[model samples]
Target chain A: MCVNMDLMATTLPLLDTAVAKCCAEPGSAPLDRDEADAVARLLKAVADPVRLQIISIVRCSEGGEVCACDLPSPLGLAQPTVSHHLKVLVDAGLLERERRGQWAWFSLVPERLELARRALGT
Target chain B: MCVNMDLMATTLPLLDTAVAKCCAEPGSAPLDRDEADAVARLLKAVADPVRLQIISIVRCSEGGEVCACDLPSPLGLAQPTVSHHLKVLVDAGLLERERRGQWAWFSLVPERLELARRALGT
Candidate 1:
């Protein structure tokens, strides 16, 4: 009855396993349900506007990193909102956050981005 | 008032412009607000799991692409749902769709992916 593999309420793990194997062995064969799902969840995390912008700004910053405290003003957004977005991006492995003094700084994780780029297989 | 450069609700276009120029010129230094915002939006598009899987499946396909009609069954999804996901990926310039005889075939756009890789500057 489900048209989208994503429609299945409990298919997350199955999809993730499928994608994990597929990404782990790119030249082997097509990705299974589990692997595909894992990769998707990661993507979904980065799919929101707020999260993406946070990533872009930090990536484009000098040294490809930014301090958590300096982020809110340029975006003209509330502190909590920006913090929430940063949390999402960092959790997804796309951005790496580190604590220094009383502030946290973020920078892009090139390996993760490279993994996505490689997924294109183009 | 804001902590993130992304705190501003109306800064979408500004970020977009900044990212466009930055991407258009990769060798350049840090991205401006508009450029970062734009890049973030594009990243936002591919951030969803369903969308990422669709791209992944198509990318892992035999010819680095896939036929729309042949996709749903493998992913255990429905037609309309899969179609919606494809539209998002295509709209983002990550995948290209072409009509041939009885179905649509989608292939990755390497150039776009390459641009993204360059954006990492790592």
Candidate 2:
């Protein structure tokens, strides 16, 4: 069962592990279950083609934001499909959403990506 | 329909886009379907809790390598389960494996993670 860990900000290791060094030597402690789950959730969010494209669209957008309506046409996907991808990204904390009028604008969260990059055991 | 683009290294975008700048402008071209697929494949490999823990364990090993037989105890998982995760990481180019005697040793692939990092639209 998936736990809604959103509210327990103090408990999640995202911030702590974000700057943690990669495992470079043997005998190091393994990633605990919660740490692995937290990192995996971030990775899963970017594990889809549609989501990756959606992230790229939002990240590339000038003014650091893109409207929900502008996403589908460029990717050749349906509106609902695009919206779905956006929600997943938001939930993963990889993107931020702001509602303006009738449209939702999305922006990339570089810190989240950086945390994932560091987690790669690099 | 996952094509084995492995043999056709010339065709994969892993190299070109690895250095490509993130989409930082609104009118920037979206990531092509192929690029998205390739990046997603890499992400999918690390999108699971078990896989992430496995990666961490292997990465932390000394001499930049870890024996497959030594994995299960630290992670408290079955041997076959740990092996399966190792295989997925190997297939995704995130981990490299070598055989010595009867054991398979796994090591981290920093370059692959670097590419995935750049692909995060960061």
Candidate 3:
């Protein structure tokens, strides 16, 4: 278990780096195609109404974390639909998921969201 | 002509109000459908690579504006494609366009971008 945990730690930074590289400030300079593509991918992840609401709900939840099971009713979405949106956010590095018993709980990946905010360069 | 200008002035705030109403801080609370939809539309406008690059280039340009004709080469896109992206940005209120002779110039609408930044609540 310790070896498995060590391996997991080593792999996570690589994902963070990928997110960071794509989120370079857009107002700082003209973005090349690759930078633009990466940044756009991040934006697209949050570009849907359902996804935007999901992020908002997760961010504002008490203790800064929310359970996947608790999301659907407030969102007025079905379970599968909410799950799909959560998956998209998790894939985007905007949210991290942890399994607690039989259910997954989510917390904001604050750094990733900050990178997205800065990428907008407002 | 003065009446036309006055009419334009009178009409613009309603549009601004609409944009403003929808861009409320997302982290403040869960977003209702309309607010989420409006925010999503703004995100969608900037959610493409070419459009994101256009925004960056325009923001970084001298005098805070760029002519429509100058965008294609840097973006490696054709004029018509660039124009379509510009229209999307303008329609979303993230950009304002001015016609100077035969060329159209574009500049950022700082407030709109700021609202988007705040909406992200990072």
Candidate 4:
């Protein structure tokens, strides 16, 4: 389902209230324009089919995390391309990385997902 | 933050479980590849700031619904452009549209949002 915003004004109140509650600091710093831009970039990062599919696959793997070594084979993508994508995800704070010998295992950071979810609300 | 799938291996289990539970069709069919693409497109649709902002504004508005007329002014975008974005959102099933008199108001469909959320899981 493609959800374009112009048709989604109704869900705005709850969505906005959710975002407002999360992003609006309580008597403290709030999300600035630049911050919003940054967050938007992050959202943009996973907005693609390939990226979204990767997320689903990783989450569906044996553990909540997966070794990068096993990735490219399934995707039929080049190792460098996968590495670049991983870097982007890492930069966004959406994933955390741990290097064990030759394997680099990356996993989801739930708080980041929660935070992004909140961004949607505001 | 932008969650690249390369880094979200961790959130996979929970996300996948959630999606499987919701969309696995009980004892029926499961999400196929084509379905995955469709859902991913919906996410891709809202990956941009312009569309995301429209969501925020519409949800943040009074009663969680906003008229098409009041949209362009805030974004400083042309009416047709705004209309196009709205059409995209509507097509994605994220936003629902209603026409009353001379105005066309669009609002968020929470179930659709929830469905997208589920898609993130599996």
Against the unseen true structure, what C-alpha lDDT does each candidate score? 0.63, 0.73, 0.74, 0.62
Q: What tens digits encode model 4's per-residue C-alpha lDDT throughout A22-105?
A: 344224333333444545665666655556555655666556677888878766688888888777676666678899998899
Candidate achieving the largest TM-score: 2
Q: A34-77, model 2: which lDDT tens digit per residue?
A: 77777777788888988877777766666777889898888898
Could you give candidate 1's per-residue lDDT for residues A2-114 as a string of tens digits? 34323434654554455454453334456655565565666566546566556666655667678988878878789899988887776666788889999998888877765
CAPRI-wise, candidate 2 is medium
- The TM-scores of all predictions, comma-separated, are 0.66, 0.85, 0.79, 0.70
In the predicted model 2, the residue pairs found to clash are A25-B60, A26-B61, A26-B62, A60-B23, A60-B25, A61-B26, A62-B25, A62-B26
Error of 2 at B32 (Å): 1.3
Model 1 stretches astray by more than 4 angstroms: A1-28, A56-65, A107-110, B1-33, B119-121
Q: Give stretches of model 2 more than 4 Å off.
A: A1-11, A18-27, B1-11, B18-27
For the record, the alpha-carbon RMSD of candidate 3 to the native fold, in angstroms, is: 6.0
**Best model per DockQ:** 2
DockQ of candidates 1 onward, in order? 0.23, 0.66, 0.40, 0.18
Query: Candidates 2 and 3: which is better by lDDT?
Result: 3
lDDT of 1 at B51: 68
